[model samples]
Target: MKHEMGRSDLLRRIQEVEFVALDINLYLDTHPDNMEALMDYNKYVYELDQLKRTYEMNYGPLLNFGFSPSQYPWRWIEEPWPWEI
Candidate 1:
């Protein structure tokens, strides 16, 4: 049966996807003409965005400093700090 992912699971997924996207980004910097790599990069980027949005919606804002919007009473402050998470 499918199970719901916890906060830490979501965070881990985001980190993994982000790492893959960054690695592909660096590769593309050296091989700009690689269509396959470019396509892969785009796919991963889209996945990363979706994952972050899901995480934020379930938990809270993943970022501060105007990167992520807050809800009533400033929900960002309600979530645990990054280190605590």
Candidate 2:
């Protein structure tokens, strides 16, 4: 089932995923032999993938997929204006 999340909520979630990915990436870089960190990093990566998929499926694709999928011609539209939320 899909939940109707506000644009701000989606943005916040994506930011969280980015932060976790960065943290895990840095940990792995410094402690390459740490199995637990590696596992956590993998988990975070999977979460990030899922989050992206959810956002794209619910809203429009966050990044261009090389071709447009919208029924009408599209232009870059900013997410709900920052102040509107």
Candidate 3:
């Protein structure tokens, strides 16, 4: 019973993962000695990377300013703005 995620759904997932990773990052800033927290942070970061890659592949680049490469015809402008999503 696997469900395929749509564009917005995938974007939401990416946001959620990003949030978790950031929260863990802040926690680690004060508790750098916690190995478990560090491991969880790494896991979430990897997941975030994969989700971002998948989103770019299915839709378009999630960023600009040399952060993401665009195909011919300049896809960065072609895709909807972040607010539109």
Best-to-worst lDDT order: 3, 1, 2
lDDT of 1 by residue, 1-85 (tens): 1126888888888899899999999999999999999999999998888888887777788888999876666787784854477
Q: In angstroms, what RMSD does candidate 1 have relative to the true structure? A: 2.3
Which candidate leads the pack in lDDT? 3
Can you write out model 3's per-residue Cα lDDT over 1-85, one digit (the tens) per residue? 1226888888899889999999999999999999999999999998888888887776778888998776676778874754478
Off by over 4 Å in 2: 1-4, 65-85
lDDT of each: 0.83, 0.68, 0.84
C-alpha TM-scores of all predictions:
0.89, 0.69, 0.89
**lDDT (C-alpha) at residue 36 in model 3:** 100
Candidate 1, residue 26: CA error in Å? 0.2
Candidate 2's TM-score reads: 0.69
> Model 3, stretches more than 4 Å misplaced?
1-3
